[model samples]
Each structure stands twice: as structure tokens, then as C-alpha cells.
Target: MDIIERFLKYVSYETTSNEESETTPSSDKEIVLLKELVKEMKDLGLNAFYKGGFAYGDIKSDSNKSDTIFLMAHVDTSPDASGKDVKPRIVHFDGSPIKLNENRALDPKVFESMCYHLNHDLIVTDGTTLLGGDDKAGVAIILDTVEKILKRGNYPNIKVCFSPDEEIGRGTKGIDLEYIKKDTDKIYAYTVDGGEIMGFSYENFNAASAKVIAEGVSIHPSIGKNKLINAMEVIAEFHDHLPKCRPENTEGREGFIHLVGMKGLVERAEYVYILRSFEKDELESFKNAFLESKNIINKKYNKDLITVEIRDSYKNMKEVIDKHPYTVDIVHEVYKEMNIPCVDWPIRGGTDGATLSHMGLPCPNLGTGGDNFHGVYEYLDIDEMKTMVQIITKIMDKLE
Candidate 1:
């Protein structure tokens, strides 16, 4: 199928993943789309399988080989937005900004990057819901590219994986990495999970989640004066200790300590934080800063009032990618050959590649040409999507 046609069909399914659920696939509804993709891959004369209710397919070349390449994309949208009944509208632009539904223009004033797609046909929404292009675009691109490779009959072995609950950050949770290990001899893979046409990323944040719990001594409001310990006040102080310059306000490779959630009461209070950075030293500094803040709060308030829990989420992929320089060269060469500007940057966020790269597999992130992900203004450039297909073909040609 054509890229656009594939994207249209992929977007039709509401594969929005759930974060709260403990299930592997997060939401069982995601399988609805995964099964469809399996059927489509089978129809294309490729070997496909859906294991553990997750959409995972392994496509091989005509010749059997000891090595392979893995191409991966997620199947779920973010639960933060409405993924149900996504209405996609296609428009060809000639430098004029696209107007969403009700004539609401996709103003470049807000999303300046939207202008990068000025001359291409775009698939956008009517502003009520997300376009699911955050990943469906990647899926379509990979499928289209694989189909072309299969048709050409000269490509090497290829492995395809469609993971669920990526938006919720559990895309790799239930997935057995052994599947990849047992299925193929390839130790390298690439996740098509980024934005921009020729974008390539190997550096991602070393992430950790922290929960600060404060025990408050509840007292009668009339007698609650100095005798009562206010947990909320202590929590506020803990929050204030974080430097303003260290927040998301400072963008691009900068580390930040983000307050993801907080709740407080007289009896007790709790606050959740996500600490992220590209450098391990920066991550350590952030953690130490938080620990110091906790100590300060404990000394000022009740020494036992504040307790901190810091858990490592994922680590930066740079160290692993450094060992496999060929993977980086593959990405850079593909962009150069296509004459597309290749920009390398560190992801403030995390990806499946971060964990996978550490798991004996060197995987990097590739752009999907989508913007404003996880929101109503999500969109994809048609020309860029096609270029991605060509890049994949180029990668295969180089392999041969």
C-alpha cells in the first residue's frame, strides 16, 4: 500500500495506550489494530506474528542469514489526548498555513516548526483530537519500506516489531527481549519514534522517578497553629529548592527536575517527580540536589517527616552507541545520500532504544516527520514520509 493510504488506514484504529494499567499491552484495544497489521503483512507475503497479544512481526529476505536488522514502531497513542474517532484531513500547502477545523489555522506563530512542511501535503486533524501520527506515521513508513524491499527482492533479512503502550512509557515492559534474541541473529535495531524528516538521535536522557513523602501531624484547626505540622508547606519548600533555570523553560539537552504530580493533606502528603538528563553527572547532580532539599526539609520540619524514594527508570544510550559507531554512521550516511539535512540531538525524553541499546542491542531513534505529538495539532508531512521510505531502501542497498 502507498504510504498515505497505509497511514490513513493505520490512523483509523484507536490504539491509544493506557498508562495506569499494569497490563503489557496497556489497553487490549490496541490489539485490534495489531491484528489488522498482522493480516496486512501476511497479505503482503511476509511472515508475521502477534505474540503475547503484542504486535510483533519478523520479516526475512529471500536468503537466510546469520545477521538481521530490526525496525520498530509503537502502536498506541497517548492517553493524554482523545484518540477516539480521530478525523484526519489532508491538505496540500503552498506556503499558506493550514487551517484546522472551524477554519482554525494551524498557526505557525505557535508551532514554528510546522512551517518546515510548507510545500508538502500534510495530514492533520480538525483540532478536536490527535492525528495519531506520533507513531502511526512511523508504522506506515516502515511497512511501506519493507514492502518495497520485499518487492525488489535484493534486500537482506529484516525484523519488524510493533510495540504497544509506548506513549505510556511501558512499551517494553511486557515485551520479552528474548523474542528478538531467539528470533534473529541481528544485534542492532532502530526505532522509528522521532520527529523531523532526516532526524537521527542516539542520546537520550538518563531518567529516574522520585516520590517525596511527608508525614504531617494533624491537629484541631483551632489548635493547629504552631503545634500542627503542615505537610503541604514542607512539600512546597521541597519544590522551591529546585532551581528555576533547571526546568523545562531551558530547552535543548538541558537537564530538568520536573514535578509530575503532588497531593497533600494535614495527615500526610506526597509529591512525585521525574528527574532527567543526558549526562550521568547531571543526573547525579539533580539527584543530589533533591536529596539535599529533602535533608533541609527534614531538619527544618520534623527530621522524620520527609522521606525520599528515587528509582532509576532508564539510562542514556550514548555509552552503548559509542561501542557501535557503525549504527550512527548508517543513519548519517542515509541522510547525506538522500540530500536531507541530518540533525543530531539528545532526547529530553526516553525511548525504547535507550533500554534496548543497553540490552545488548545497539538501537537508535529515527524521525517520523510528525509534530505536536500527543495533542490535537499532531500532523505529518507527506513528502517527508515518502523520503523516509527511500532512506530505508537506501539503507538496504548499502547493506548489499
Candidate 2:
């Protein structure tokens, strides 16, 4: 099948991960699609299997080389939006606003990135659900490239993995990297999970997530007078103490503290935040800010009613990519050969590559020709994805 056909089929599976679940994958639905991927890899004559809610595929090259090139993409969609019953629409852009549904339109004025895709076909969502283009597009690109390479030999040995929980920062927790490197002298990898096909990243944010719980006393309003303390108000105080560096306020290498979710009652409330920065020191400062806010609020109330928990997500992949310059240099050479006009963009968010690289695998990320991922306004440029398939094949041939 072609890239478009493969993408449409993959996105039809509802694989939104659950962060609250205690299970290995955090969700069972991810396995359904993962099994299908294993079957497809087997059909391509790849030694593929699904284990621990992750799928792995291996192909041995006829070339007498011990070097292996690994291509990876996540199988789960972001929990920020619904992935169920996604309705994908294809629009041939003509420099006009395109309607996605009754209440939503893919307006060029709002999304200036659409300007680059003008006069090209775009695969968009129906405004009610995310199109799952984040990594599904990456999956299709890898699969398509694998098929073509199988037809034409002389490529390096390839390893494929479709990891789960990448959306929730648990992508590399289940994989065995030592085993993947057992028989190989050197391994090179690319996580096909970035946005915009012309951009790739060796650096991503040093990331963490914080959870704040506020506790207060509750009583009847008529009799409560000075005795009642609203938990929501306490949570609000914590939110206000945070710096104004939010997702909307920061760009490029700037960091941000994003309030992902909050829920509360009169007596108790909680808020979740994701902190991101390109520098390790900056990320540390953000974590300190969370603790400082908790200190101030508890001092004011004269009670230990606030609790803070912060956990590291992933570090910048550049820390590892810097050691092996070829990981990034090889990609640039391939893009130069393809005349793709690629950019050395920095990732504003974290990916599976960041964690895997730090684990001694040294993987960089490639783009998928997509934009506005993880939400209703997400879209994929049809021509860009197809072109990426060829670029990936070129990398396979060149790296060998």
C-alpha cells in the first residue's frame, strides 16, 4: 500500500494512551494496532513480534556489514485529544480557508504554517477528533520505506520498533536496548516523530511533570465565617505563582510551564503541569519554582496543606547526539542529496529519541510532514509524507 493508504488504516485504530492506568502500556487499545503492525512486518518477511505491548521487527541485510540502521515510531496518539472515530478529510488548498466541520475551519490566518502547504493536498481532521498524524505519518513512512528497500537490495540491516506510551513519557521503559545492540558493531537510529517534513532535531526539551495538591477546610457558608478555606482558591494561588512562561508565551529554545489539567472540590484540589526547556539548568529552575510556590502557600496558611511532586520526563537528546556527530551529520547529508531544503529545527517537546539516546542508543528524530499535532486542528501534507519515504530510503542506502 501507499503512504496515504497505510496512514489512513493505522489511524483508524483508537490508541490513545492513559496516564492514570497502572498497566505496562497504560492502555490495552494500543496492542490492537501493535499486533497489526507485527503482522504487516511479517508479511514483509521481517522477523517481527509483539511483546510487552511493544512491537519489534528485524530484517537482515545481504550486505556483509555489521552496522545496523534502526527506524522507530510510536504507536500511541496523544491523550490531549480524542482519537476515536476520527474523520479525515483531504483538501486541495487554493489559498482559501477550508472548513473542517460546522464549528471549525482550517484558516490560513490562524495557522500561518499552512502557507507552505498552499496548492498542495492536506489530510485534515473533522475538528471533532485529532487526525493521529503525529506518529502515524511516521509509521507509514517507515513501513513504506521498508517495503521499497526490500524490493531493491543493498541496504543496511534494519530494525523496527513501534513503541507505546510515548505520548506519556514512558516510551523507552519497556524496550531492551542491550539486546538490540548484541550482534551489531555500530547502530544508528532515527525516530520519525517530528513535525514538518523539512525539519529534523537532535535536541529536545529537558522535560518534567509536576502534580500539586491543595487541601483546605470546608464548612457551611452561613456558619463557616473565618473557618472555611476554599481548596480551589489555594490551587489558584499556586497557579498564579508560576511564571508567565507558558506554551503560548514561549517559542524556539525558550522554556514553559504548561498547566495540563486540574480538578477540585471545596476541600481538595489538584493541578498537573509539564515543564520544558532546552537547558538542564533552566529545567531545574522550573522545578525549584514549583517547590517555592508550595512553600509560600503553606507559610501563608500556617499549615502543611500543599504537596508537590515533580518527576523527570526526558532530557535533551543533543547530550548524546553530540558525541556521535554522524547521527545528525548523516541526515543532513541525505537531505542535501535529496535537495529537500531541510532545517536543523529544535524540538519544543520531548520524544522517544531523547530517552533512548541517553540510554546509549544515540537516536535522532526526523520529520513527518505534519503540523498542529495532538489536537483537532492537526493535519498532514500528503505530498510531503510521500517524499519523506524516498528520503528515508536514501538514508538507508547512503548509511550503508
Candidate 3:
């Protein structure tokens, strides 16, 4: 199948990962797509395997190159939106408002990125669910490239992995360099999970998460006075106490603390926050903001009513990528040869590349020609997706 055909097929699976689940894939539905990927890889004549939540595909090269290039994309969509029963259709985006449904429209005025997509064929979602183009597009590109390269023959050694729970930041849990390294002194890995056509990132946010729980005294509102401490009210006030460094208020290297999930009542409340920054120190301060707010709120209530738990996630890969310049050097040589202007985009979010780099792989990130990921408004530029195939294929052809 073509790239677009494969993408649409993969997104049809409801692979929404559960952050609450402690399992490796976090959701059983993720396995449906993972299993299908393994079958497809085997059909393509690549030695493939499916174990746990991870899928691996190996392409043998006739050329005995010293370097083994690894390409990766995640099968699971983001939990922030519904990935079930996705209804996708291709639209020829003009410079006018494109209707998603009766109530929603893809207007260039609202989403400025739409302006760039004029005269382009885009695969978009219905107003109800996300299109799942974020990494599905990445998946299709890798698999399609695998097929094309094998047919072309005499290609460099290529390895591909499709992971689960990437949106929840658990994609790299079972993935390591040993399997992909196989008889090569140097490994060049790239995570094909970035957004936008020009996005090539070597850096991403240092990330962590904080879960806050507040306990309060409940009373009948009619008979309530100072004795009544609403847990919901306490949680809201605790949020207010922190600096206004929120996702909406920050951009482009300016870190933010974002509230991802919340549930509460008068007697008990819980909220989860994702803290991010380009700098380690800044991320530390962001984590501290949660503790500091918990203390202030607890002190204000004169009770130990608030409790917080913070856990560290992946760090920025720039520190490690800098140590191995060859990881990015090949990308530069390929883009220069292809005459595509290099776009050094820094990811405000994290990727599998982040954790994989620290795990000794030194992986970088590449764009999948997608935009507005993890939402109903997400889309994939069909032409750009095809361009990505060319870009990756060229990189493989040029690999020494």
C-alpha cells in the first residue's frame, strides 16, 4: 500500500493508551495495531517480531556498512483525545474555511498553520475524533520506505521499531540499543514522531509529572461556615498560588506547567500536572512549584490537607546528541544534497528519542509532515508526507 493508505488503516485501530494503567502498553487495544504491524513487516520479507508492547522490523542490507540506521514510530495515539473509530477523509485545502462538521471548521484565521497548507491535499479528521496522524504517519513512512528500499535493492542496513504508550511518555521502556545494534560499531537512530513538515529536532523539553491530592472537610452548604473546607476549592486555590507559567501562556523554549487531568468533589480532589522545560534547572524549579504550592495551601488551611507526588520523566537529548555529532551529521548531508532547507525546530514536548539517547542510542527526531497533533483538529499534509518518504529514502541511499 501507499503511505496515505497505510496511515488511514493504522489510525482505524483505537490505540488510546491509559496513563492510569500500570501495564507496559498501558492499554490492551494498543496490541491490536502492534500485532498487525508485525504481520505486515513479515509480509514485506523483513524479519519481524512482536513481544510485549513493542514491535521490531529488520531489513538486511546487501552493503556491508559499519553503521546500522534505526527508524522508530509509535503505534499508540495520545490519551489527551479519543482515538476510537476515527473517521478520516482527504480534503483539498484552499485558502478558505474548511468545514470539519456542522459546528467545527478548519479556518485559517483560527489555525494559522492552515495558511501554509493552502493548495495541498490533507488527510483530516471528522469533528468527533483525532486523526492519529502524529505517529501513524511516521509508521507508514517507515514501513513504506522499507518496502521501497527492498525493491530498489543494495540499501544500507535499516531497523524499525513501533512502540506503544508514546503519548503517555512510556514508549522507551522496553526498547534498548542491543537489538538494533547487531554487528555494527555505530548506530544512527531517529524517532519519526515529530510534527510539521520542516521539524527536525535534536532537543526536547526536560519533562516530569506531579500528582496532587487534597483532602477537605465537607459540610452541608446551608449549615457551612469556616468549618467547611471544600476540597475542590482548595485545589483550585493551590493552582492559583503557582506562577502563571501555563501551556497557553508560554511558547518556544519558555517552559510551562500544564494540568493534564483533574477530578474532585467537596471532600476529596486530585489533579495531575505535566512539568516541562528546555533547561534542567528550569524543570527542577517547575517541579518545586508543585511542592511549594502544596506547602502554602496546607499552611493556609492550617492542616495537612494537601499531598503531592512528583516523578521525573525523560530529559533533553541535546546533551547526548552533541557527544555523537555523526548522529545528526548524516541528516545534514542528506538535506543539503536534497536541497531542502534545514529547520532546526526544538520540540516543546518529548519523544522516544529523548529517553533512547540517554540509554546509549543517541537518537534524534524527524518530522512526519503533520500538524495540530493529539487533537480533533489534527491533520497530515499528503504531499509533505510523500516528501518525507523521499527524505528518508535519500538518507538511506546516502548512508555510508
Candidate 4:
């Protein structure tokens, strides 16, 4: 199947990952796509199977090359928008505002990148749902490139993985690293999950998640004076103490603490936050600042009213990518050979590459021809998607 056809098929399944689920795949719906991908891989005569909600496939080289190149993409879409019943529309851009629905439109004024896509075809949504192009485009590119490579014959050993729950940051948690290490000689992997055509990322935020719980004593309103403490008020005070210049106010290498979600009643309150920074020390300082705020709240209440829990997610992949410079150098060389513009930029959000890089696989992220991901404004440039396929083919051919 073609890239567009495969992408449309993949998105037809509601594979939105659930962060609240305790299962491996997080959502059972993700397995639908995983099984389909595995069947497709097997039909293509590659050794393929689904394990732990992940689809794994391998194609041995016709050549005696000792090195292996692994290509990966996530199958799950973000829960930030509705992925169910996504109605994708193909429109030719003439540089005007493209109406998605009565209330929403894709405007060149709002998304300046549409200006560059004038006269090009784009895959978009109906404004009620996200297009799921973020990593589905990546999946399509990898699958299409691999199929083409097999037909031509004579390529290095290639491994492909379609992971689940990437949107929830658990994509690599269920990956079989032992299988990866044993199948390949020297593995060099890249995740085709970056946005835009030319943009590539090796640097990503040092990420950590924080959960704060506020405890309070609830009593009848008539007798509440000086005897009752409102947990909602305590939680509000905690948020007020947080830095005003947050994620929205900061950009380009500046880190910020983001309040993602909050829930509470009078008896107890909970706040979920994510801390992001390029530097580990800066991330630590930000985390400490939150703890200090908690300390102040505890002192003010004269009791341990607020408790904080912090957990590390992933670090910048540059630390690992820098060790093996060729991993990135070869990609730049491949882009130069293909006359594709290479844009090196820091990823404001984390990717599967960061987690895998930290897991002993020196992986960086490659572009996927997607824009405005994780929202209704998401789109995929058809021409750029085709170019991404070419780029992947070239990388496979050039891999030693």
C-alpha cells in the first residue's frame, strides 16, 4: 500500500492512548493497529509479531553488512484531541484559509507554515478531531520505505517497531531491548516522529512529572470558622505560589514548570505538573522551587498539608547522540545527498528517541512532514511525506 493509503487505514482505528490506564498498551484499541501492522509485515515476508502491545518486524540484508539500522514510529495518537472517527480531508493549498468546519478553519495567518505549502496537497482533519499525522505519518514513511527497499533488494539489516502509548510517554517502556541487541550487530536507530519536513531533533527537554496532594479538614459551614480548612483553597494557594512565567511565557532553551491537570474537593486536592528544561541542573532547581513552595504551604497551615511526588521521565538525547557523532553526521550527509534542507532544532517536548537513547540505543529524531500535531490543526504535507520516504530509502542504502 502507499503511504497515504496506509496512514488513512491506521487512523481509522481509534488508537488514542490512555494515561490513566494501568495496562501495558494503556488502551486495548491500540492492539487493533498493532495486529494489522504485524500482519502486513508478515505478508511482506518479514519476521514480524506483536508483543506487549508493540509491533516488531525485521528484514535481513541481502548483503553481509554487520551493522543494523532500526526505524521506529508510534502508533498511538495523543489524547489532547479526539482521535475517534477522524474524518481526514485532502485539500490543495492555494494560500487561502482552508475551512475545516463551520466554527474552525486552517488559516495561513495563524499557521504561517501553510504559506510555504502553497499549491501543495495536504491531509487535514474536519476540525472536530486531530488528523493523527504526528507519528502515523512516521509509521507510513518507515513501512513504505522498507517495502520499497525489499523490492529493490540488497540493503543492510533493517528493524522496524511500531510502539504504543507514545503519547503517554510509555512507548519504550515495553520495548524488548534484548531482542534489539541480539538481532543487530551495531544498532543505530532513529525515530521518524519529528514535525515539519527539514526539522530534526537530538536535543529534547529534561522531563519530570510532579504530583501534589493537598490535605484539608472538612466541617459543617455553621461550625467551620477556624475549625475547617478548605483543600481547594490550599491547592489554589499552591498554584498561586508557582512562577507566573510558565511554559507559555518561556521559549527556546528556557525551562518552565507546567501545570497539566488539577482535581480536588474540600477534603483533598491533587495537582499534576510537568517540569521541562534542557539542562539537568536547571530542571533540578525548578523541581526544588516547587518543593520549597510546598514547604511554605505546610508552615502556613502549621501542619503537613501538602505533599509532593516527583519522577524523572527522560533526558536530552544530545548527551547520548554526542558520544556517537556519526549517528547524526550520517543523517546530515544523507540529507545533503538528497538536496533536502536540514534543520537542527531543540525539541520542546520529549520523543521516543530520548527514552531509547537513554536506554543504550543512540537514537535521534527525524522529520515526518507533519505540523500542528496533537491538535485539530494537525496536517501532513503530501510532497514532504514523499520526500521523507526518499530520505529513509537513502539512509538505508548508505548505512554501513
Best by TM-score: 1
Give the alpha carbon lDDT tens digit for every residue of 252-349 in model 2. Answer: 88999999999999899999999999999999999999999999999999998899999997789998899998878888998998888888889887
C-alpha positional error of residue 223 in candidate 3 after TM-score superposition, expressed in Å: 15
Give the TM-score ranking, best first: 1, 4, 2, 3
By lDDT, is 1 or 4 better? 4
lDDT of 3 by residue, 277-352 (tens): 9999998888788889999998888899999999987799999999999878888888888888788889887778
lDDT of 4 by residue, 40-111 (tens): 999887899999989999978888877898999998999999999999999999899999999999999999
Candidate 1, 1-400: lDDT as tens digits: 6889899998889988877788878788898999998888888776888887566667666765556778889989988899989889888877766789675778777789977888788888989989999899989999999888888787777778888988877777766677777756544588987788656899999999899998888899898877888888878888888666456487898888888898889878999988888889988888888789888888886477888899999999999999988888977888887788998978878889888888777889888888899889888988888888888778766663
Score every model by TM-score: 0.93, 0.85, 0.84, 0.88
What TM-score does candidate 2 reach? 0.85
Residue 233's C-alpha lDDT in candidate 2?
94
- List the candidates ranked by lDDT, beginning with the highest: 2, 4, 3, 1
Mark the regions of model 4 whose C-alpha exceeds 4 Å error after superposition.
Answer: 213-242, 262-271, 294-307
Better of 1 and 3 by lDDT: 3
Clashing pairs in 4: none
Off by over 4 Å in 2: 210-244, 258-273, 289-310
TM-score-superior candidate, 1 or 3:
1
